[model samples]
Target: MTRLLNEEIIKKLVTMHDANRIIDQTFQGFGNKTVINPSKVSLDLGETGGYPFHEGFVNAMPAYIGDMDLAGIKWVSGIAGERREAGLPYISAMILLLDPRMGEFISVMEGTYISNLRTGAQTANSLKYLGFKDKVSIGMYGAGEQARFQLEAIADLYEITELRVWNHRRETAEIYANEMKQYVSGETIICNPEEGEKAAQAEILITVTNAQEPILLREWIKPGTVVFPMGSFQEVDDDLILSVDKIIVDHPDQALNRGALKKLHKEGRVTEENIFTTLGQLAIGAVEMPNFQEEIIMCIPIGTGAMDVSIAGHVYKRALEQGLGENYSFINYN
Candidate 1:
């Protein structure tokens, strides 16, 4: 029998704290070289006859965690603008959990919720292992679903004094500010387009936008601020990438193939040598901690399949314990 779970069932099975704990183990697995997370392959969906698929892409990510005995793959699609225009979710994903012993499929689960939650939990783990001030101020560049989760995780970890938001759409930012008040103890200011600097003044700056080009400048970044660019595309300037005292990543291969570092690597300006260390190394104490009070750091947290599989495996076990999901016989023993 194979278990089948949907988004609602997944929510009941896992919490943000659960995500944080699982992703922490995933990072440690990477540090200890017990995880196999191959670089994800992307299929670009070019313009398809009247459909807005020019910017659409599907990614296949697979990973295995040795210590936890977890293995799985996530197939996810990103069609932001087109889906948003049609009032549909911009991101969709599915996770398939596999038996480690015989490579049998055991569970099929919705992945969007897990993906978003793990992303935020990964950031929280970064802050925890890297260190952060007790009272934190966050500068958010996008007001989307990811931004909300990021705030939720951060708020749970620290006392948020202020949140400065700047979205390309002013109305969207305004609405986000009002709705996100539950996560903040202080104030949420909606920065104007011309006030990107004001929004960048914080202990942590997160860029979760879909901008194809750089919207954040090097000058806007302050000392001691940790910048997190969560998009698959470039959202911060080259100078900022070069000027950061330290750059951390989830996977060096994926970092060199995607995000702001990828473009810089192609131009012969950045290389694997320039990467200070991986989040895993930092999490496992394999590397020296940065002078976080005086130096700026860039932590590029690219999505990893190891995280998806680990989280999904945990969820599958929880579902079995709670008797939550439907189980159907996919293999007949006649």
Candidate 2:
């Protein structure tokens, strides 16, 4: 029997805490070199006639986590410049879970929520392991859906003293700050006129923007500040990349293939040697944290298929326990 789970059910079953826990365990497996996650395959659908209004791409990510005994693939799509005009999400995805022993199909589930949640969990984990301060003052560059999840997951784990937000559109930042105020115990300020001022004030700076070029600069970054840039595109200047005290990635290959470090990696500005360690190494105590001094640290997550499988596996188990989805026979024995 294959269970069919919808977004509503997935949203109901998975929480920020669950995502953080699952991702933490998965990274431990990664640190132990026990998980198998191949590079994602992407197909560019450039100016395709199907989507007359927007360009899109499709990606397939597959993985197997040995420790959890779960195998799965996430098929996802992203369409550009449709959110405002078309009222559609920029990304959508689905996850297919398989029985590890027999290779039998187990369940099909919505993946957008899982994707957002796991990405957020990854950011939270980076902050947990690599960040210097117990209490943080956050400055965010973008106020989109992913930013919301990042706030939720981080807020669940730490005490945020202040959240200062800056977006290209002031109204968008204002709206996000208003909606997100409930999540933070401290003040949520929408930065106006001086965006760099806010970035300088942050103990933990996060950028989730889609900008193609750098918006953050090395001079603006303060000592002992941890930066998390969640987008594939560049958000910070090259000087920041070259001068950061330490650089940590979720996966080195994936980070180089995409994310904020990709451009630098391609141009020979940064390499595998420049990276301090992967977050997985930090998670499992495989690497030692350097002595705390006034330093700048950057953590970039390109997002991994193993993370998807781990969270999806957790959702599957909970759904099965509660009997939340409809089960149908996919294979017939005559």
Candidate 3:
């Protein structure tokens, strides 16, 4: 039998806290070599040729967690513009869990929520392993749905007293502010129109933008700030990358191939020597946490399928235990 779970049902099955813990454990498994995340296969479609002409892409991400004996694949699709005008999510996905021993499908679930939620949970776990707590001010670039999840997940573990947001469009920033008022005080949510200076001058700076070039400069980063450039391409400049006290990433291969430092990696200016550690190492205590209070620590979380699959496995089990999802028999050949 295979369990079928939709986004709404999956949401009920896994909370942010659950996702955070699962992601932490998964990272630990990654560090200990009990987890495997293969490189994703991507199919890129040229521009849409519409108003925004956002590029479209689909990715197939597969993973296996040996300790738990869970294996899965996620098929996800996204576009640059996300069809926002038509009221659709930027990313939509589906996750299929398989019994590793038999390679048989055990469950299939909606993956968009899981995808957005787990990425945020991973970032929060990174902060936890890095030792951040209490009354943190957050500055964010790119006020979008993913940004909301980041703040939401972090607020579960920390006290967010202030939130400063910057977006290319002012209306979206205001919308984000209104949407995030539950976690951050309405009075403290400042929407910045300038070139991301006010947003960058916080204790925890995050960039979720889709910018191909750098928007955050080295000068804006304070001595004690923790930076997370969570976008696909470069959001922070070379100076910031070179000056950070410690550089941590989710995976070396993914980080070198994409994300903020990809350009530097290609230029032979950055390599494993430049990265201090990975989030997995930090989670497993293989690497010591840096002095986040006195140093500029930047964590580049390019995200991984291992985290998603692990969370999916957890959610599937929980749903089964609670009888939350619909069950259907599979491979019924007479």
Q: List lDDT for all candidates, in order.
A: 0.88, 0.85, 0.85
Model 2: per-residue Cα lDDT over 196-260, one tens digit each = 66655788888888777787899888787888878767888899888999888888888887778
Model 3's lDDT to the true fold? 0.85
**Which rank order by lDDT, best down to worst?**
1, 2, 3
Q: Give the top-scoring candidate (lDDT).
A: 1
Q: TM-score per candidate, in order?
A: 0.95, 0.94, 0.91
- Model 2: CA > 4 A from native: 47-54, 81-84, 131-133
1 or 3, which is superior by TM-score? 1
lDDT of 2: 0.85
Candidate 1 per-residue lDDT over residues 40-75, each given as its tens digit: 998776412234455577789999989878789999
Cα lDDT tens digits, model 3, 122-169, are 888888888886667889888888999999989888888788888989
In each prediction, how many residue pairs overlap at the backbone (N, C-alpha, C within less than 3 A)? 0, 0, 0
TM-score winner? 1
RMSD in Å for model 1 = 2.1
